[model samples]
Target: MVIQEQIRIQTRGRNTYNITGEVSEAIGRAGIETGICQLFIQHTSASLILCENADPSVRTDLERIMSRLVPDGDPIFDHTLEGPDDMPAHVRSILTHMDLSLPISQGRPALGTWQGIYLWEHRTHPHQRNVTLTL
Candidate 1:
């Protein structure tokens, strides 16, 4: 059998926010001995990614790449409900990931030695993010 849990977070966009601990905690609480832990972000403007768990510089580079790929305000964007980053966030999300699947072992997510799950918020301000964990 599988269990599902929703972990909520409010974050300031423009950087990588580590969610490994949160997911692991959820998985631990789920009490699954062996299964796949699936994580999905329920927003078009939000994204998910697996990144380096130890170093912060990796996250900095990721933020830089995002800025270069999706500038704050581009002339091609039409949807700007929240601000300049609103549409860009959608584009970033499209370019990035929306879901992830991780292995579960001993009631925990089976991550590598230096692997971490991150919530990549691309918005312009602080926003609430919902991370759905289906194990």
Candidate 2:
């Protein structure tokens, strides 16, 4: 069976959000015991990632590194109409990912002990993000 659904995530700006529980819930709802669950973020300014969720410091360091790698308000970007962060947001998404595919076992995402699903918001302001899950 193929099941598809979307979840709305409200983010407080550029940060990694742990959506592991949400995804597991979706898998439970789907009632698929041993399948694959794919997650896709339906936005250009945001992305998805699977990373270490055991430590908050990992996320903090990632945010810091990303900011340095793609500093906002750079004069090099031409798509500045929406604001300095607009173009940088797009770039950040490009550098990251738009989707993730994880194995589902016993109605739970087969993630590692230290791994978690994350929605990486690239924007500087809060926004409603939609994540489509296919199981």
Candidate 3:
């Protein structure tokens, strides 16, 4: 069986949003006991990741490191029509992943304890991000 759906995520600027519960709920609705769960984010300035959701510091550190690596307002970037964060956001997305594949078992995503799926919004402002889940 194949089940597909789109999940809208309201992001709070540049941050990591845990979407594990939403994906799990979708998986439950799919009723696929044993299969592969594929997730794709339909945005250029945003990406996806599977990381440790146990501590807030983990995400904070990631944000800090990424900001340092891809600092906004770089004079080298030519794509500054949107804002200082425009090119940086795209660079961040390039550094990360646009899709993820997880195992489904017992009608649920087989994520390990302390691990969770996330939408890493790289924009400087809030935006509605769309993630498509296929099970």
Each prediction's RMSD to truth: 1.0, 0.6, 0.7
lDDT of each prediction vs. the true structure? 0.88, 0.94, 0.95
TM-score winner, 1 or 3: 3
| Candidate 1 residue-wise lDDT, 1-135, digit = tens | 868899998897666788988998898887888999999999999899999978899988888988889898898888877889888899899999999999999888888899999999888788899989898
Local lDDT at 4 for model 1: 84
TM-score per candidate, chains pooled: 0.95, 0.98, 0.98
Best by lDDT, which number?
Answer: 3
Local accuracy of candidate 2 as per-residue lDDT tens digits, 5-92: 9999999998999999899998988889998999999999999999999999999999999999999999999998889999999999
Clashing pairs in 1: none
Q: lDDT at 129 for candidate 2?
A: 100
Candidate 2 backbone collisions, by pair: none
Tens-place lDDT digits, model 3, residues 46-119: 99999999998999999999989999999989999899999999999999999999999898989898899999
Residue 44's lDDT within candidate 2 is 96
| lDDT score for residue 36 of model 3 | 98
TM-score of 2: 0.98
Clashing pairs in model 3, backbone N/Cα/C closer than 3 A: none
Looking at model 1, report the run of 10 residues with the lowest lDDT sum: 9-18
